[model samples]
Target chain A: MSLSIRHSWFEATARQRLAGLLDPGSFCEFLPPAVAQPSPHLAQLDLPGAFDDGVVVGAGQLGSRQVLVAAQEGQFMGGAVGEIHGAKIVGLLRRAVAERPAAVLFLIDSGGVRLHEANAGLIAISEIMRAVLDARAAGVPVVALVGGSCGAFGGMGIVAKLCSAVVMSEEGRLALSGPEVIETVAGVEEFDAKDRALVWRVTGGKHRYLMDDCAALVDDDIAAFRRGSIELLDDWQETPDTLARLRAKQARLQGRLSAYGRCRDGLEIWAALGISEPERVPLLDCDELIALKEGLPT
Target chain B: MEKLEFKFPSQALLAAAPPALCGVVGSGNLEILVRSGVDRQICEISVNTSARGFGETWRAVLATFAASQAVGGTSIAINDMGATPAVVSLRLAQALADYRGGAQ
Candidate 1:
């Protein structure tokens, strides 16, 4: 099949994916690129200005309901979030509350933030976390979509976990620290960073779905992803009791810390989750996997 | 300490400006920011990297980048850490490419 830019995995930019998700002519972009605001530090270094800070944050209509969408351009520094990037996200989310949109959809595909501006990125993430909680407090259901190559990591991974509903594609991989770092810490004998299979087994969607980190898993196609997202959005108007759910999930995460502290493998989590065939867990298809076990809502 | 090296790629002769920038800021990773430069007619690129002394390397990469893409007056900026040369090049090019076209 011919490859379309809109579906070109990592090569395809954020706007391309959003175009596919929303109806043509329905998307009204906010903060177009003409408004270039670079950090003073970046300018001091003679650095080029960031276009949209690698993220496209705005509002668009998915159908009849006007939804707020934040799609990351993975092409731009792996769609990382910086100060302005994070600010735009949180600011728009507040707008969602006031506007009373049907739902909030996040197309997360980032390694997290730019290290050059580490302070700015960190602050943005903190603000974003606050916004996520604020959205919940305001009775807005937040949904996370992780189907891009970046998959969400670092601080963004924690934000994804906080979302009310999460839809992960088969290719989705989520983790706080990437495997390469783990290998650096554990040594190659303990872990190999280049091993694709090993990496997936450790952090791929299949593992997260079975472990209940991800609520649903679908195909990589944007249509499929969009449909799954819209499905969750169906209940967007009726916000979930997000704080209680978060409290419960928070307890579970804390439980992971206490029960399986620093155990970093799919098999380990599978065993902890009581799967008899820890080895077979990774190989199971979606249907069989779902039948194999029920998951905790995150 | 052993330092890491990488390159950020971006080129657009006649392109639009970027709206924002972001990325993770870990030891081996980095986030970049891009947008319109002082001039809207020239495709510009800026890189903030932890691995110093790669100034020539960045220039070479950026020079080649300028030659590769037909950029309109556009400015580029990047803030990075010790990312691999591959990731830097990919992010820069990706961001610039998105500026010309729509981001996926």
Candidate 2:
């Protein structure tokens, strides 16, 4: 299907992306800005505070089925989670468990916690993690869209991994620690922060998809994202075999850890995965990259 | 640690419902939250800024916003972080415009 150049999901704002993902005219925001739910912690520190605390939370319809939706504003403090923002997400997830929505979609772009309110942000993330698991346990499928510039890092990366499925765009990145942080701690030889290509190879969507860390990989278009999400929701069931899936995921994660535990670069892991020319994968587009990973005719 | 509150008369009313927000609280930036007000003819405003000794500047900016009469029946709450007067006015204008169903 052809995509419009104007509707690049990577460049769109969180609100625009949410509107595109949801069925038209079905979004209803909860605890909007007028509620004045800005973080008090920032005020105490004399820091600037956004009205919704960098998050837009609400309910929307995805193909006639009601779903809970939350999108982080990556431009706002790098979409960090503070006290109020964390509470809003945790509240929504908890409500989803009771409301039993068709699914929960988190357009995750956060770099994790707001360093200004470190303790509260950490605790709030813990609560959100618990809430995601709760919603999952209640039979609500949770899907994460990690396609923004901020991508997902720190606690949010773990949360995205915990979700039922993760859909990613080629520009999206996913990792526990950001490249700069890793470079600062692991030394320049281990991970160079200035090397853009190296950074993408380490955490970009193509690498994550090849590593089996992501479920669906698509082009940077909102239509692609919407289609991917609707397709997943259509096949969604109550997960009677959740335990088996969990075990399989755990084993896969463990296998990945062992496989790359000693590797200094992403190319080493790709080479181990039997890619004839690991260096060339980074140059391929989404479809070609996935096909190459799966050894399919491209 | 500076905080100020003011109310001004306006002719235009919100085009949509209450609770429209605009901007982010990044460095040298600000965020404005616009809510439904008690009086349809008045626009109430409350500003909290990290920069001290900017009360006159803030009042001047807000007063200019009020005279434009672009919005009414709204209470705007601002959280600022050392933003310049231009940015301050832009955020306030954006908030009012957004409350009137304009793009933010």
Candidate 3:
């Protein structure tokens, strides 16, 4: 029998996502809620305390290969990263490099940092970004999965893009600043902040896929995302020349700069990639959508 | 955080298809994205605002546009930092014009 916590991570339970990602009965959540590893900064600010500080990082396995996993909690201040939260990510990424696990999977859904902690959150996120890049230098596969409605923005979005592979769902979105924030910074006349379809067009999974930023765009189920992650790991294992492949990947990005530099909108990219009907492209069912162009890597 | 809600009925009209858009995702800025389906029938709009309490007014502006224009089946998404009403309609219209080329 399993012991249930009084609180949950979000709409889906933490262990539930873990179970899907890891082999059956293989997950042992480290620093779990019941273990009482809450955020220390909360007390300093007179803010209500939280368990686990909204991030869960630990070691697990994908089939027989070992993997490091980190999942952020969206319920807690939209899963903002604070000092401890960002530290946990850095620590695990470092450990993952040392262990040379088959891969590292980060379940991200954050607004970047915890404002209550101010500079701590910002600094921590900065460290987290460096850690992700380090994981790449070490040749460990890093996969960032967007699993919540928060859609992973700000610093988190930038970090997520640097992963060796990105697996986002139909609902996943990635942006430097969210729609409302953009309207404020750029002026309402320059941009419209009230259009949901417009926002999703630039950031949603379909858009990311069309842009070559997302490795695989799956349905809205965790099982699908997990399955995609497993396959990505398997592909890396089969080749084992991850670094060489990625360099070629970056070279492709350099090559495409001219084409995408002048172009804007997901449809343009879709059309350039040979989706003859760019206007009808977004309306296509996932199955009907054309395969992505051969060479870009995120 | 001050939240403002209003509408710009295309200052003209607009639409999305595998849609396209422009602008920055920055503090105090907004991004315009849309999929203008080839349909000349309807434009479906859903604005998730940090500024609460303008649903009816939003509906009114939308109604005004719908009554005048026959835009249909296009999907739109907007992220607002606090844009005024006129800018809203103008950006949408500009997005429509730019995308008529199926590029940025």
Candidate 4:
């Protein structure tokens, strides 16, 4: 394949993302399209089914380290977690526990559970969550990379948080209820779905990174993500999932709620955190934002 | 959804290589998964497309693809979501290239 100067992770397909993120000629896919393990439920609903569902799972080399990776195809069904899709992810996570890779890099770009296979999708997400925790508890780091067209939302948002660390790009959104879903259920007065700025301000990577929700934020390019992953892995010291760690995480979340529970927007939270020009936060690039965050007062 | 299958006589077999996949099953796009080990003189194609009543279009496209490319001894399965004939042809060529390139 011809090399592009900058390949946008958001623009690449699930398979393409795997090819770009891993080392050259390193990826070996699991349950690839030729296997034809499509969703058993979509056919009943008269929907077109993809051969490998909407997610690709496999083991590949990230730099010199062997890492198991799973990437959701956001273009198909919004990269929703259907029964088979969820199962593929869950299986990969479980395998991570057995064949402990250096890390499990989860490329999240889903809108959460596939609504067409509602109950099954929900069950699959739950299983995936457990499998992720199980892998982490077994001393494997599960890192999440969220920079895709669909972004990460709903149960997948919670899943991303459950990982050992999350790396995101400014365009990557991470949240529970998506902007459109919130607007549909709570009225536009509460959250305007059409206002892309507001949507990003609330759930985008900059906000998440400032809030200490994500471990790192990088540019939208695939190489940036690969570099970010390498940096994190280089600094990785396996911290077993212990009760004390859980308590500390809970306390940090509690502190965040106490500090900015009533904040109306991300700008308000940024101002409360002592940012001089919160309004300009959205315009800053990844390096500038990281510098800004570092310059903030504790 | 519609399913169409076609087989074309080919002049030469594709060079032995690993299976290859190309494209995405997104809006106005399709994915082609090509695997070897079919009849040495025939190229078999199967399509599962969202748009129904386009069997003739798919047949023509696959026929041209078989004629132009040395895709014999391969089975190509496509999952399409209303991709245009141009996209179908492009993905077919790309997939064949990837297969011949001997990379997965």
Candidate 5:
């Protein structure tokens, strides 16, 4: 099997990523461009609307088991969830409830809501969260893959956390608030958008994986992502230990708050996690980082 | 909040017909929706821009596009932010190119 070099998973468009992830010739796109169902809100706001509204969703086969997929086009408005785009995602998860796909994959690459349609976008995200929880209750695994330049922030961050598992590349950043927004609202002294190293140290995949915020952290390659996801499909139980898992996640989050609530620097958190030479973690290559993680004393 | 409409004369449809969308609505960017209209001899253009007092410029730019492309029986709708004339033309042409399933 030859890998496509034209649009590697890290650099591929939303459509290309979908094609690369799903089984060959088994992917079927819903709400195709020919349907031309753009956002009515954009028209009302005098903003141009996309026919598929930044999200491509549909059913596909993943190694024989049926699955549903939704990939966001980060190039489009940061892949923000507006009315139509959010509705499309919600619709897919809802369908998963009745259809009972083996799993649902969300290729998240959004900065959350579209400010132009803030109210509608917010409500749509809320609906999507509910749909995600409902699908999980129905025993369908929810997986989030974050790798695009936009990464995931705002409400989408919370949505990603609610998933059964998250697969992220070292390039992926998962945070509740973006660096620029933090700087603007909290002052540059609190967070500087210009400080790329600091930004990555705080929210990069390595940090999140070490903190247990994300499940798997892999290299910035589509093949690496593919291996990570297939491992989840094969290893993860269909019906997870929901109660125990929730409780464990709750404990981990509580530990974070208690341990780092007062810390201002990301290095402090890294040092507390027992990483030597904390500053170098951000500079380490993906393979080196993974090896270091593997070599950690258990 | 400004809306402008224009009609152009042509006999052949664009490379792509109606119901095709190209572009995104970003900070200073815009989106274009191309639809096939009933009439075969007229190409319709409508624009709604966030910027004000650019009606004449829009008309000039769009008129030139209509004359050059000679797109017929198509209804083009645009949502613009503060995109310049150059960006606007590029987006319009890109929209048409994408509608034809060509490389962007």
Candidate 6:
């Protein structure tokens, strides 16, 4: 409960993160494990099912403001999205649109869709994306926090990008295709899964923050994430999704592609951004990195 | 996957006891969901596990748990992914302690 004691966000479970992020005794879980239904599909494949379907969705107080929260449990099936899992998130987003909470904090830690429930999982992810966009369009801020073991990959990566803002720790990764999957399909020569340094450089939060993908970056501490969330809420302004805003985002994406499309590594991309010592970027602390980004030309 | 059920006699729980959940149904792990409003004299447990042919092990674990904890008028559901007997015993104690509003 004391913010002074460092609590590693990456090590904490989904429930534990919720307890640490929200005010004490403020969390009221939507589908507590006791009554919530587990995935029906897992049983057909003789797999164990988790109550709450590996995702915890509920309403809670963040600082003094009421917020809706959902955290994916990476320990279970890599926090893969299933029919029930995606539905819970969609339900929370829908509630956000109606209730218009201070914000919707999505603690994303999933590796994407559940492979066992392949097609169903894909469909569920699509529905969740739609619900997230719908919530944002209705002037509800959907903020994503990424600092878990699984990180955010596959469909969930897209969902995180669709949010109003994203907060990430250096250990948090955000990418579409995971490294292992890429290596499996494209061969290790293309993207070696065993190359830990390369993997982090490509998908980790520092790269994302420098590229202007994530709105904020913090340490791997739960208290830091809580502080980041509170700061975002304090600076919150209702910017409903619109055609013009989407076009602007698309233009920024096009600019990034044109600028560094041929860069093979994260260091190259940072060098192109005019960082004199791109290799040293990783050694910089959170404050130092943010200061460096500020000094860079837009 | 296999489903197993067991019941044991123990002391009754208070009527207003809150439900508690412990652990996650991960590989080599299990989750225990405990709720009150069951038969006052019996503690019922149901297990849905990925590991088959381990009913006897489950029975022994639950029997020991029931003997140790006053968990009557409660129902427990366990979703297990091949957790060992020791892990099961630990989770059962933690779940019961959590149910009784004690530190986990």
Best by DockQ: 6
True contacts kept of 3: 0.00
lDDT for residue A1 in candidate 3, whole number 0-100: 13
Q: Candidate 2's residue-wise lDDT over A240-275, tens digit each?
A: 346888799789779878878998677998888888
Report the alpha-carbon TM-score of model 1 versus the true structure. Answer: 0.68
* Residue-by-residue lDDT tens digits, candidate 4, A26-142: 998888777756776887776678888999999999998999999999999999998889989998998999998999999999999999999988999999999999999888999
Model 6, residue B80: displacement in angstroms?
0.9
Q: How would the docking of model 6 be graded? A: high
Model 2 ranges off by over 4 Å = A1-3, A238-244, A296-298, B12-16, B82-93, B102-104
Worst 10-residue stretch by lDDT in candidate 1 chain B? B1-10
Question: For every model in order, what is the iRMS?
Answer: 8.2, 2.1, 13.7, 1.1, 3.6, 0.8
Give the whole-model CA lDDT for all candidates, comma-separated.
0.70, 0.85, 0.67, 0.90, 0.82, 0.91
Candidate 4 wrong stretches, greater than 4 Å: A1-4
> Which residue runs of candidate 3 sit more than 4 Å off their true CA positions?
A1-14, A237-255, A262-264, A290-298, B1-104
Model 2, TM vs. native: 0.89
Worst 10 residues of 6 chain B by lDDT: B10-19
CA RMSD of all predictions: 7.4, 3.0, 18.8, 2.3, 3.8, 2.1
Worst 10 residues of 1 chain A by lDDT: A1-10
Indicate the worst ten consecutive residues by lDDT in candidate 6 chain A. A1-10
lDDT of 3 at A212: 69
Question: Please, what is the TM-score per model?
Answer: 0.68, 0.89, 0.65, 0.96, 0.82, 0.95
TM-score of chain B of 2: 0.88
Per-residue lDDT tens digits for candidate 6, residues A2-73, read: 458789999988998999999999999998887888888998899879998999999999998999999999
Clashing pairs in 6: none
A255 Cα displacement, candidate 6 (Å):
1.7
Please give the distance, in angstroms, between residue B10's alpha carbon in candidate 1 and its true position after superposition: 24
Clashing pairs in model 4, backbone N/Cα/C closer than 3 A: none
The candidate that achieves the highest lDDT relative to the unseen native structure: 6
True contacts kept of 2: 0.76
